[model samples]
Target: MPLWLPVGMVAGVAGWFWLPGEQAWEGLLLSMAALALAGFAFGRGGRAGRSVAIFALSVAIGCGLIWWKAERAGAPVLARDGIANLTARIERVEPLPARQAVRVTLLPLSCSDEGRSAGVCDAALAPQHSRLRRSAVGVIRINIPDENAVPGLAPGAVIALRARLVPPPSAAVPGAYDYSAVAWFSGIPATGKALDPVKLITPAPTGGPAEWLADARIGLTAHIMTELPPGQAGVAAALVTGDMGGVTQDDNDAFRRSGLAHLLSVSGLHLTAAVGATMFLALRLLALWPRLALRAPLLLIAAGCGAVMGIAYTLLTGAEVPTVRSLIAALVVLAGVALGREAMTLRLVAAGALVCVLFWPESVAGPSFQLSFAAILSIVALHELQWTRRTFEKREEPWLRRLLRELAALLLTGLVVEAALAPIAIFHFHRAGLYGAAANIVAIPLTTFVIMPAEALALIADCVGLGAPFWWVTGRALALLLWIAHSVGSLPGAVTFVPTMSRAAFALIAVGGLWLALWRTRARLLGLLPIAAGAAMTLATHPADIFITGDGRHLAVRGLDGRVALLRERTGDYMRDTLSEISGREGDDAIALDDLPGAVCGPDSCTATLIRDNRVWHLLATRSAYRIDRAAMEPACAAADIVASDRRLPDWCRPRWLKADPNLLAKTGGLAIRLVDPGVTSVAELQAAHPWAMVATDHDDRPLPQNDPNFARRAWAARDPWRDDRPADAGGMQR
Candidate 1:
């Protein structure tokens, strides 16, 4: 435990700084202070402790160095506030068929061209890769360099350019994924529009190992795809090298539903299998030739193979956080064996983890790193118990019990690791597989026996065109198993959606799960805790509490209360029809103007939000009847409580509504609804209306939904309303 402690601290810190939020910052700061104190204690301790302490310090420093270099590599080059033609170097040149972009590392970025220095006090940022994240000084981006015009532009190539620094985009589409964060996670230099002259001062070499590895992978993928059918190639590639990029999204989704996605991820399973195979063969081959026993090199052979496998997997996966972590751990284990030491010391594990965190600090925040290490740590704990000593020492047990024990451990490991990531999984996906355990049960063995082995053989056989048939067979078998997994997963009541849970609940789930996994006493008893908490959480959830419902499908909610209008993103029948079903479940005929929850609307029933435009239009459906009560409706679009299509809006409403419909006007790329107090106008004013002073353009600011129970599914007519309009018809305006 003591040996593993430092690694835990490293992991914890990585977890801390990884998120870059208030909680993440707090965790990071606390963990860093704790590490410092530990270092101090170790330093004060005499002799051996001091040596260990120094080594730890070096490892820590090394980690920091790696992180700093990575950040620098992605930093942008740009001048500060003042205008200046700054000299910079082309940090990276990425080519796309249509266009290209150059990531630049600015040197001595300054506000003026008067030989001034930035001096690290400048607050202005330059362009950078990973646009959403802050530029770590000395880096930015520009338009793709002109190749023929510029002598040469490549990595390590210095060139001069003038560029403007722009902020990264922050908005996530209303109901879509956030690509900004994805790009930032991948460390993409700025998404820039500044393309200018770049005169290369030095030429870069043709290819590097990373470059060669990429080409090899491409060749392998092409070979495998040609040999396998449909989903077969993806499965084969994934088993062999952990590459699943070629897998179709639909197949990927199916794999996920079946809990088979982990099989494709380079994790403890693959590492363990490879390590076991290498060690067994090494011991056997060496033991058989007793004459060479003195110089058998068993450990060396095993270690070398392990290192190769780890490196190969990392190469195929492009050094992703989890894959890197696994590879590092594997290398650490192999190194220990080769050196005639124990497989791992607490210190060695910590050093490896620190090294990884230092170089790729951003991984400290990613789920992959956390889950990978968590799973690995759990396995280490299991091995340490020594109860399974004979299981490895001798194989006298029957195959049946061995199979059962294996099943138990596999299921247990999945439970432990899944428990660790459950909170994040829920926060990000809002989905839980009710029978995830069952799904993993079938997926793991099939992957181990048929998929990965065939994949390894196929790679070798492909060179001579002899492995295609074997790979094809493996792919089809794996696909069939995957199909079973997905089919079973989709069976009645297989997946249970819980909108989303609170962070507190997620935290509880995480803690309870870890406690259960690491518990030593009545360990089985502790398992009940996470299960119970999960059950309680499930019971506490309500769909209407999180969604604005229309009919029986999902819709959007606005305003603090119901006093605002409803706006549905018009996509397709599946989307609209499902939403209608969801709304109907709550028996909503029309949203009441006064019932726009927590909203302050205009003279009419338009909802008022503090969003960018400061206004919001009442949501009116062209298809489904407005389930909101008329009282709850806001005076949106400066018209009646009910909203009409774009062509039907009154003359005064056109300008305001047009501004909202930027998509229709082809002026904006987003949906912005305009809010108005249409129902507030007096008849006298309506009769005298010209511009109608009441007409509004864009909204002022859309307020963040801060109300309790921020999500609402369906808004049924207030019980015992003054009148119930079944049709909710507003005369000729009804669509």
Candidate 2:
């Protein structure tokens, strides 16, 4: 490992982490840092100037490729002062909040002299099959007059709409971003549903060569599905057309548990198989032509196969992000072969990663991109070390030894890659498969050997009507694989939730594991440092003393050590699932907003106190129906410690859980966060009154406003007041 490499990687890591946020100058700074580091590494290695120039050029080319792609995907085109209107064909139809709207790809249309956009053409029409009346002009929530509007409306119909000419999508979510505004710069036209009924605007494309090919794939997949056993049909569909519809959640869970879920999408595995199969068959046939064989390079032939198959798979998956990423990665490797640089090494793999980074910077954060590169890096390192070893170099091995070595290598690589992802998996997902390695052993082989190939074969056979027997073979193989996946996934200890992981833990799992896998000699032993760092972090986490929901539904308290967690409710009924996920406590042990009224549970007991401005009702017991929860929520001022409503109905859910509450609850989220034990104040009550005013206690209590955890930590870290006593705001600051 050269100094420049690691330094460059760290620089790359910084860029990768922050780029998603699109903090403009951060990218520039990281890139410059990487450039400097690479320079230092080159100087240390004493590399020539020409090599450095080539590296720079490669990076430029990569960035150029990505920018080109960004421009092509219907990126928005910017215009000057005036409003413009155009009539374009409906390129896509989407189901928005109220109506069936089509995204019309503008054709040559005109703008208004009044500076307002011209009206759209061919608004919604009463379908011969649809009599439903709809408006034609302004944006209205109405269904499209087509029966086939569910899966999607046709792409090439003509529709004219008069809309406010927006530039592009500047933001993703409505409030957070106007992605529409951003699309303006990218050249994407912003158009909405038409008010007038859409007429038979344009002829839909059908029966053309491209259409026929697409239809053939669809028709073949459907035909194959008819012959499979009922239970196996969905898996076969997923493997064949890349339609994951047939795959049940159970099937997905099984595949995920087995670490082979990536196979469901027609990605790297599919392309590799298609390309490899084609090359083998082509080479075998071409070998018979003695004269041309020597002149026609195998590289060219293989590259062709890779391109054709990669394109085929991409189209089949509708060019989805993961599929596209894999396609691009595969092409890089294939391109390397064509360029006579077929050697597999870390630099080449990094080059591939750089290509991805340059093209779709967004993919730098995607899980597929992360896992793909991790595996590739580990494999390349191990392979290089193997070739470089004294005894292993140019040495013959016994067949048994070769077989064992291959198996060991495969297992070791898989484990290394999986381990490398552990910290992220635990931090983001909080779940890990305990039996994943075992499940992968049976599932990966079965899927690669029996499922995908058989499904593809069945599709091919169906096209020629030699379907029944071929379909039968596919059905049997798919059934076996599906069965194996489900059975393994259902194993008792298949999945376990990892409570949490910190930064140190993540570094350990990713960098340390990679170190152990490829580091040479005793120096490799140092990798354990990261692993130990992670383990220590996990063990020392000292649970969160207080838990607050982003939605302000419920809050819980663990022990003094922040262990033995309890929530206000089992379900995040008041808000999003973030609370349930964050707490690592689920099922019946949930606490509700009102349960604690105003109390904090410590290592000892609980209390029931109230803050200001909100009404609090005490529950002598627990019951179930809070049907009016959404419409008639408890109203608490920004100063109230807790606004609670206790009912006396039977606990329909987790009856036993209601009986076992540590009994304290706090409504988290919102301005409900308060300064240290506002004696009896809830996070909300204190805010509404002095909403604009901030606390001046500490970095946290400086009190402009604070959310949970941060409020607690920062406050705790602050210098305490001279005394722990504050004048009365409510009954007791329940503790």
Candidate 3:
């Protein structure tokens, strides 16, 4: 019963996001009213009915909470790709490897053709006469490729720059990550890369508490980097300040592969270590004065100190979803200690989750929340087992035996957490670390006890100008941790990749996990049934044989050698990585289409033969810079089963299966085709056989209905709000 409230809340929030498009407000309100009435009617029933009534009401509240949040967060999204000169104030700045990541809020500005002819805005721009007609407002995440390009830039500084900006795009493929939706909720409308030099018009002011905290974090990170070597400095900064921009890509990859990447992020582990140390110091100091200790509530006083430390640490670390969740849970435990009550329970977790949902409802759909909660729930459940409790009970025993018992318990916890989080990691990132348990056995203790403590001491001692010794210790500990990550990551089978699975399957697994972790009796064992079923469904998932980008300019096909071949050797990193992830393959070593055994290519066209389900299928695509003569390419196009091209094709050039040319792809952002033995014989059959494969899109990639009543209110859902005419180059939706 204690679990039902959070469960209902999660279900309602998740349901809102999982639905295909926006729901009618009228319909939602009607449903909520009906549920509320049902709850009132059931109030007279027994306790069981009352429990159901409470759950129903909670679900209704959850829906309303998320819906309201979505409505309030709506802002204007950039309609298309263009060169926009804008004046903006920097809201936040993060240092990355050789780059400075800045999130800026755009001010009122105008775009003009004269700005382009001055040799400033040229790459991927539309007609020279066209300009940004929409009022571009909201936060835009821009990356200055050179870290030192904009000197002395920090949060609250106003600067002017002409940057190449584009709207937040939709999923590259069906069921892929949707950045536009995330931007919609997070208030980031566009992302850009700098083209010209940035001009700083104003310096950062001595602002509010939030800006001061940001400035302090930046200064601390700079000091840490200056004192330590590059390899260790980035990790040290991240452990202390949660700014991971300086960590090299190779090091990040090593950590992820080794399953030790969590060390680099601030989460429950960091909070617990910080709180534990604070409480320990407080208790020891109190003990030093026996008279005061006897007269005071030492435990309560220490709890207060721990709570304050935890809260401070959370704020310093960016207050990300995982950190905030952990803070809430830690605060609950501290409150319980002050009240002399048991605090570590599923009920406690439920309370934290409920509060998080009420505040940051969008986090429910993200991997951070899911993985964090999953890992903790699994550990708590493992400890709740009777067998586990009896095996680790306190008793008179040899020191060596107790040491072995503790080691076993640590290993067991690692395995349980790994098993619980593997599916989620793969679902979000396409790969999960295989040896993370072994990696964590060493890396976790090193980070929590050795590295983080030394780093904290170094930061504190630096205030008095005596931090060199502590800084050296922290650097050396981090060096050892990095070495372990690289060594483990290089081992064979360190990570595993899986094809993306359905949301339904993930939900089933999640429900089963909760059932097993929340229940205290024999009923928990039955959770294994759904878990196994979900795993089976996951295994049954199959990657598509062919993939096409939203613009139809990029294509990836599974070749005869079981490796994926790209239509062109040169393409954007985003497109290549997206194709690789969805197909369960690595993108770095993509083979050229012409080099494949059963593929042939010309300057203007290419054809590849694929054998699937005992049938040979031919794919034809255009690579021409100009529209070729339709008559000359008719035979080849007619022979292939699937045809793709960015240019519009003649009506007579229809393929037997799918036509992913400009006209169709404009409506469907991207296409991922899974060939079957008895596939649809004609393109007309696609609507019935493979509608789910289509990535719906408008100008902004929000797959909303054209006639949806609320479309006007949602910028991303509306057709380009600035310009009415389409571009001549078949750029899907142009403003």
TM-score of each: 0.60, 0.62, 0.86
lDDT of 3 by residue, 9-43 (tens): 88778766665434443355467567767766866
Q: Which digits, one per residue and each the tens of the lDDT, describe model 1 over residues 1-735?
A: 344344444534433333324454444445555566676686677655554544454434434443444444443332222223445545444332112233333433333443133322135444323323554543444555445235454455555554444323322122222333333444432344443565555554547875456556555655766777756666666665556655665576666665566777777677767666667766777778777777767668767876776676776655656767777777877887788888744355556666666666555445566556555555555555556454443356899988777777767656755555555555445545556677777776677666777777777787787886877778777767768766966676554444435444555555565555454677646766765786578457433312222121222343333222344333344333222222221112234333445433332223322221233223332323334333332223333322323222233442222222221211111221212211111111211211101122253432211111221111112222223322323221322
Selected candidate, larger lDDT, 2 vs 3: 3
Clashes of each: 96, 70, 0
Cα deviation in Å at residue 545, candidate 3?
1.2
Tens digit of per-residue lDDT, candidate 2, span 90-195? 4433322112232334443333443232222223111111211332222211224333233312444444333344323221101111233223223343333333
Query: Worst ten-residue run, lDDT, model 1?
Result: 686-695
Best-fitting candidate, scored by TM-score = 3
Task: Sort the predicted structures by lDDT, highest score first.
Answer: 3, 1, 2
Rank by TM-score (best first): 3, 2, 1
Output the number of the lDDT-best candidate.
3
Q: Distance (Å) between predicted and true CA of 650, model 1?
A: 12
